[model samples]
Target: MNITKDLVPSIAYQVRTQEGVLVDEAPVNQPLEYLHGHNNLVEGLEKALEGKAVGDVFEVRVKPEEGYGEYNDNMVQRVPKDVFMGVDELEVVCVLLRTRI
Candidate 1:
């Protein structure tokens, strides 16, 4: 079925920076699923995926504004490596989730 609003679509994707740095990816055997038209994905990606069908393969370039908003220098903060000492692993783009009970 064609992808459309309110439908759940499963996709294997790779995200890269304009400089060709690999940022993120999902393997075909384990695709990412999201609810369409519900702001579940970046704006440009959602637009590009609209109307696509299963097994379709394509590359989309999403600009800063469309993807994660423009980078701001003021938001940058220098943190000492020692701050993360004792952590089992530290990697770029690692997400830490905190749940409130």
Candidate 2:
């Protein structure tokens, strides 16, 4: 059966930074089956393929504002070293905080 827009599974796609580096790849090689037009995929990519078919190689480049929100320092926080009473491996960034938790 030829894959159409509606009947096709939620297509799986890969994303990579434009800097000649592999940023991310799909978890699986098989296409993921999901209903479309339901915020199933990223807005930019989905919008580009509003009426596309399977085996069609399309490209959608989304900026930080669209693809994923800008990196916020708030995502990361620093706590006192003593707070970790008994944690063997507490890692922040690349630093290894060896404490007993």
Against the true structure, whose TM-score is highest?
Answer: 1
How far out, in Å, is residue 21 in model 1?
3.0
Estimate TM-scores for all models.
0.75, 0.54
TM-score of 2: 0.54
Taking every candidate in turn, the Cα RMSD to the unseen true structure, in Å, is 7.3, 10.4
Mind giving the per-residue lDDT tens digits that candidate 1 earns over 1-101? 98899999888876665556666777777878889999998787888888888877777767667777677878879898889888877666621111110
Instruction: Give one digit per residue, the lDDT tens place, for model 2 in 1-101.
Output: 43335554556555554443444444446645655567665655556656666556656665555445677888867788789888767653221111100
Clashes of each: 0, 6
lDDT of each: 0.72, 0.52
After superposition on all CA atoms, how large is the RMSD of candidate 1?
7.3
Regions of candidate 2 where Cα sits further than 4 Å from its true position: 1-12, 27-29, 77-101
lDDT (Cα, 0-100) at 40 in candidate 1: 90
